[model samples]
Target chain A: MIRMNKFIKLAIATCIIFSHSSNLYARDKLDIKGFLTIAGYHSSNDNLGFQPHLSSSDVGYKGDDEYLTLSKVGLQLNYQLSTQFELVGQIVAQKEVVVDNSDRIKIATLNYSPTSSLLFRIGRFAPRTYLLSDSRLIGYSNNEVIPNHDFYAQLPLSYVNGADLTYNFGLSDGVGTASIFTGRTEVNINATDGNTLNSKFKNLLGFNLEYQTNNWLYRFGYTQSQLANSWEQVDTAIQFLTLVSQDYPSPLVSWTEGKEFVEAYRVKDKWFRYKTLAVQYDNSIWRVRAEIGDLAADSSNIPKNKNAYVSFSRTFDQFTPFLTLSAIKTSSPRTFSKPDEGLVQFLSAQSNQNLAFGLQQVFQFAETSAYNQKSISLGVRYDFALRQDIKLQFERKHVEAIGSNLWVVKDFSKIKDEYVSLIMFSYDRVF
Target chain B: MNIRILIGLICFVFSSVASAEILVIVNKNNPISSMSKQEIIYIYTGRLMAFSNGEQAQPIDLYDGSQEKATFYKITTGKRLSQINSYWAKLSFTGRLKPPLALETQQAAVEYVVNNANAIAYIDEKYLTDDVKVVFRLDS
Candidate 1:
């Protein structure tokens, strides 16, 4: 009797999942779906501070943890408010940030589709950097490196906390549903200089353009953030001191890049603009990808260096082998950069471009020719999937060079360009 | 030529034709040319959406997890149950498309398909009827 009851319960649950309700017959409406993946993996290269936090390779210096973790479980809600309007929201529970909590609100935003090719979205959302922005940390179906980077996600400007506009041009027929974007994002952050630097995240405007066709897709975005001016920074320091003496805590939530708060709170003000460019192409058997980006204090004063990488993937039925040769001409200001270039500077540096070379494999129980899911991946990708929606993948990489802000901190143990890794695994059925 | 060898060859041809029995199929008076075996496979597998006359065709299958369902999978798609499930699972998970609607039994499904001008249903050659046209035949 007990066995029969358990079987019945299992059947009911499966039925509920397979026959879930969704919107139909409406141009603008809501469509919801979800994914769940769980897998086990181990690796030799403990990512430590050299890698993103999403991969099994990111085992840090000293800690006791599990050999396997629940990779990711989350739900996504997409609503078509109108023919030209949509709202997409996603929530995930990752092992790092939402470790103790299962109820994590990862993304919530509204998108307006003016045409089959144009879109405008606003709110907190995925920055859409790297390869797996749309695929996320689905571990079971991707190369080991993709989920690792996307899930162990560095603190990147990929997602801005404001508004974005995107445009796509291509046939809506053959390649399924694919789109690209050329949009701008508005954000506010604390500058390294004492002044707020226009109170707009170092006062930088994000410009991005993207495209996806039958076999290839690409995106390039630029943002300008004003660094602190030495003189104005001094003045702001004096004002902040006065405010403190008059009994007020600091009102600024985010601050300037490369400058730390001292007794007098002095800082420098300069403009740093970051440009991110990425491209990927795929055929039936072979695939290739490349990304390049930079953070400049201006066109001429590009003190904060950036880097890029290119990798190739080959698929053999259920198993895929990947080999990547990546290089960074300049230092990774973000991954190898410091935390307090003020809030704006820190974010500007990390998560954009840092370079390294690693090899990994993915195991998909079923063929995953189309997309990555939490259940479609294994190894580092699986772990990344666990934290798919709400995650904080970071490492404190220490760079030791003369006349450099990162050098001044001198936490030599975890220094070098930060290396991040992640993984996700899953199984699902939709009807 | 030996007389016995010639007789054997004639018997082989006769048996081949005997096994290739013609079956009748019915749909509510839709004008379509005869379908090849490959074309029927495409229709049932959801690959080719239109009929020979450029009309949108809807092919129906029995509800999965039944005897008729297994038999159809073996003959129509030449795939095992697991392969079909995985195929549908991959498509559905990616949010691109869904499997066709299922019915409870072959008889009920056949009745519905015969009544709908755009519908298609499969049956064994032994059950040939005057109501429908023979668009395709199974080889194995």
Candidate 2:
């Protein structure tokens, strides 16, 4: 089970205090707002657990960790320094299963707008890679109790220390916006040894284009970055293979060629590209949203994957019921050599089977770790009062064998294709 | 006969309250005479911050969940108050934009707009005064 940090406890207390008080900080030059979500989730299976995002570690909403799966609180401060320049800072304490300073401070930026159509911002800000990337933490702002895990959990990058420029114009009786950003980022993920794996991204560049009308919004976005750090596990395996290649006694099979294969599949220092297209339609009665995205990399360790989801919600006065279907699949699945392969056979004949097995397992460890699942969820949102809402959702997910990477499992050997049911409830409020 | 008369009087009161027309108002010196429905949407939603004449505009709203606020969004954008709040939440949290400045009551909204030349707001037609001019109207 994951331990709750002291910061999260303090955040909950602050939220409760803020909720009971009026907007005492509202002023002409400064405004303060806070949001809170008290949530819990339960999973059907005990063998596997659920995480909200890919970067989250192995322990999640199962066993004794159910209560901490989704509860969170956040506060934002906006100070208008001048008519043309403003400063904004927001802090959130949630899901700090692995506490990192960067993740807690979601946005800290200085904004400048010379004209109504052009704007600039610099500091730590979220990259708008998806429709909801920037506002993912505000549970009260979203339509679903939980976003599509298959789609949102694929990429762990949330905020980037960056600067961006945005230009808005009128087009087709709608408002069109074009934005470009450049920054560097870090993503902390679960390591195979139950530790944290830090992935550093450098020279990141991205752009987003959007057109929004009264009832419809269309978006297209793209981003590319280079991995700045090596995958330690894979790198160690490659080094071991290189040593074996130089020491092999027999020339019957070229161990050097086997070493080359591992070298070619390494993900370190590789370039990654991602693209997304999304659309949303809302008439205050029916809300429909759909999005498709793909992440591509040249290395085998980071396989190319595609994810998509469509959601529909209809409002009935104070109640809104929603249905969503989401899915993800690896387009280029990673594969590893078996003992029967030529390299393994040669190594076995020389009585170095342990080395061969170790190499095989190391290569396969990351290969088998890919997200491939289909999920459908039905939920209802009840606005019990202004600025307060409660939601309950039921989701069924079908996970493919060897594709339970998004889930934390007790035993990798026991992994198989199975259906998992999940129930989630959350109370969200903003003040 | 007395019960029927009481019921008729209650119906009249409720219908009049429901049928009141809403008028979008701005400072009389804003230089803009009238606004299109789309422009009003753009302003209230934080999409457009300037008038068609290139003058900066500030939009104001009645406090959250107030009857006048709900009726204004319903008539203009066909959106419930919750939806509008959700939309504003997305923008404000991003630090990209903020919703219109909220005033406690219809009278407060009128005073806010009247005191600021760039300000815009909406209120019931019965509250119309010389300090502010009607730029758009929504009939119930």
Candidate 3:
């Protein structure tokens, strides 16, 4: 992998040098573009904080006032090396509410198209995982302040390091495209407890099929990945459970035994699969988009889930009013049974119940994996000037007690099935 | 009867002024004689990069905020200029395709077509010149 990375870097450098040397007088060969979004949002609840996406840092909008959690700027460059080859790069700058936040390259790829119908790209680029995955960061291209959280929050991954091949052909009255991509990526998610958690995805593979007519687009995709490293917090809890179980063994109840529990929730080397189907229709007046996805994993800790969302919008002159309904539900929920009363009493006699208390905390940690929530949003976008628009949106949500995985909370025990309301305003522009 | 005829005449004039005649043009040396509306739409939208004859195609557009530009897009795509811009923004950032080069006026568009055999552009009928060949026409 290290050698391959070095090779890709060298190839990109070579393309840049060749293009500059050959086209010294052709200034039009290199095109530069940029986009910006300045947004502020406020949530109604103070107990929990809201972030635009899970991959973002934990510091976000709280109840006290509006926060700058949704503002970012990006610049993209497309260098045409030749009729058949081009190099593209993009960088985004935004505030990272956590430690070690800095601007990074979002895309750096060398694209080659030998024929009008076929294309190949190598280097780091956004995989065709969803309809808008490739353009997720460009707020000027999106209708809402953010994508539907229920559907997009589950996968915070944006780009991968590898290559992809695409073939598009005219089918009937529309175009049909088939693509295959493979890469490896690392994801950093700030846990609700303020700890930065990292997961490495190895052997990542995915394929997508799309058919787009003048007014409608349909897509189907499948992606599979394997976990390259163990989750730190989960591992620590499992180890603690095993140590306590050794001192207080429960012969009658196997799950209460540490070894059995650890085996059930172990996620290392496990495979995770994602399948999605989406459709979109747009004309001069009305635009509609809908998508559904299913996520499956080998370990119980990574519970199976199904998520869906539908968005509708109508354009009237320079104003567009939109409505979106989204939901995510756990298909498989894990439950933990406490140790028997006799075992609790025995632990109290030996260790003053501190070990028993630790065991209970471990159970609570396991239950956090299952998430459930639903929300509805209404927004309006006004094109006040050319190539610029301002949007105002309001959202109401209902989160099942432990399903607050999407939000940052210090104490999980205080979470309850509650309603959350949020309001956001943003100005988006492109040049 | 005279009053009704006057009102009808005014409506006809207004409608005529609302939608003007637009023409799709290519260089005179280009072998292609004509193109369909769908093919033109595909080229302008960056879906198809080559002509029917497998020759590379370069599409040009009028700069933003022009009346003729807005009307042309409205008649061809049935979409507002802002929406079309947004769509291109998505495609541009994804690195899939780039939008056509935008000239300042129809005269520049015609000049661009005259210089490049593979270039295609749209202009008002008034800008018609002998240096370019008309491949498609949108009548009011």
Best by lDDT: 2
Per-prediction count of colliding residue pairs?
A: 77, 0, 0
- Which window of 10 residues has the lowest lDDT sum in candidate 2 chain A? A332-341
Deviation in angstroms for B79 in model 2?
A: 1.8
Per-residue C-alpha lDDT of model 1 across residues A1-431, encoded as one tens digit per residue: 01223323443464365443321112215456554443322222232222233222223222222222334444666666664566676665444322123225545667765543345666655544434453444433344423333222322333335555654332342222233332333222222111122222334345556665444657776655544344443454344323222221344233232122222233344555556777788653466877766654432113345555566666444334555444323342221121222332332344242111000000010111111111112221111111121112211122222211211112424333432233323332222
Residue range B1-140, candidate 2, lDDT tens digits:
99999999999998997768899999988889999999999888888788888787889888775788898898888988888877787788888887788877888888988899989999988888889999998866
- For candidate 3, the share of real interface contacts preserved is 0.44
Better of 2 and 3 by DockQ: 2
TM-score each candidate: 0.46, 0.92, 0.86
lDDT string for model 1 (B14-68, tens) is 8875664433254848787477665565555444445766566667665555555
Clashing residue pairs, backbone N/CA/C < 3 A, model 3 = none
**What interface-residue Cα RMSD does candidate 3 give after superposition?**
3.7
Model 1 residue A111 CA deviation in Å: 3.6
Between prediction 2 and prediction 3, which has the larger lDDT? 2
- How do these models rank on TM-score, best leading? 2, 3, 1
Candidate number achieving the greatest DockQ relative to the actual structure: 2
Best by TM-score: 2
Prediction 2 TM-score vs. true = 0.92
Show where candidate 3 strays beyond 4 Å.
A1-27, A97-103, A241-261, A334-355, B1-19
Tens-place lDDT per residue, model 3, A1-431, is 01223323433343344321211122348887777777767787766677677777534435444434566666788899998999998877665533233226778999999997788999888877888888877776888988788888778886788888988777888878899999987787766666767778899999999998888989999999988888887787666566445544345333345566666677788899999999999886899999999999987667688999999999999999999999998875555565665665565576554656666676766677566899999999997666778899999999888777777775666778878898888877777
Give the Å error, residue B72, model 3: 1.5
